[model samples]
Target: MPPAYVEALGSVAAVLTTFCWIPQAVKVIRTRETRAISLTTQVALSVGVVLWLLYGILHVSWPLIGANAVTLVLLIVILAMKLRHG
Candidate 1:
């Protein structure tokens, strides 16, 4: 396993990148405006995140697993909104 500080740093970075989707999600939720969002992009991103999550699970990497899990959920929410709104 990596050092404690290394894992901490990984977790910190993961948190930042993972939660960065919050603003987009909140905007979509509030405005119900997803016309500008690209279905292809969201689909690709969700698939990538799911793959990353699977990789992390197989490797037992907490940072990757946690980040990708949350990212996948956010992407799903956005994708669902896009489908519903558009």
Candidate 2:
């Protein structure tokens, strides 16, 4: 395992990157304007996030697992919105 400080750093980085999707999610939810969103990109990104989550699980990396898990949820929400609104 890495040092505690290293893990903490990873956690901080994970939180920042993971929550960065919030603004976009909020905008999509509030506006319900998903016509500009691309289904293909969302699908691809969701798949990639899933894969990253899987990789994190396999490696027993908490930061990677947590971040990717949250990201996957956000991606799903956006993708669902895109499908519903577009």
Candidate topping TM-score: 1
Clashing pairs for model 2 are none
TM-score of 2: 0.82
Clashes of 2: 0
Worst 10 residues of 2 by lDDT: 7-16
- Clash count for candidate 1 is 0
Instruction: Give candidate 2 misplaced runs (Cα > 4 Å).
Output: 1-12
For each candidate in turn, the TM-score is 0.84, 0.82
lDDT per residue for candidate 2 within 7-84, as digits (tens), equals 788778878889988888999999999988889999999999999999999999887898999999988889988999
Tens digit per residue, CA lDDT, model 1, 1-86: 66998978877887888999999999999999999899999999999999999999999988789889999988898999999999
Deviation (Å) of 46 in candidate 2? 0.5
